[model samples]
Target: MVRTRLINHPLVVGLLEIAAGEIGYEHRGMIRVLCDVEQFRQTIDLVVEGD
Candidate 1:
């Protein structure tokens, strides 16, 4: 996976934290986050999937 610099953005970091907390310990680092302006709805879905 090509880790993007966007990973450091506050919004991305906040989303990642929420995802990590929701998924819990076992699946901590297994999830992947992607962003696409053309697919706004789907991107939001991915962000909240852990919940």
Candidate 2:
């Protein structure tokens, strides 16, 4: 069975904060990004690559 994981790594959290800031919102302290394992891995790769 596929399971979901919560990603709270500092890099990922910082990225999310930056994104929320760029869009101009209070960031209310709640965020949800859903993706399968492969997509999640790809996202992390992109972030690591700074792309």
How high is the lDDT of residue 44 in model 2? 74
Query: lDDT of each structure?
Result: 0.54, 0.54
Clashing pairs in 2: none
Q: What is the TM-score of each candidate against the true structure?
A: 0.45, 0.37
User: What is the per-residue lDDT of model 2 for residues 1-51, given as tens digits with 9 covering 90 to 100?
Assistant: 212232465546665576666654654655544445676576677555663
Per-residue lDDT of 1-51 in model 1, one digit per residue for the tens? 324654665556766677667665466445644444545454444545634
| Residues forming the 10-long window of minimal summed lDDT in candidate 2 | 1-10
Least well predicted 10-residue stretch by lDDT in candidate 1 = 32-41
Clashes of 1: 0
lDDT of 1: 0.54
Top TM-score model: 1
Q: Name the runs in model 1 displaced over 4 angstroms.
A: 1-3, 28-30, 33-51
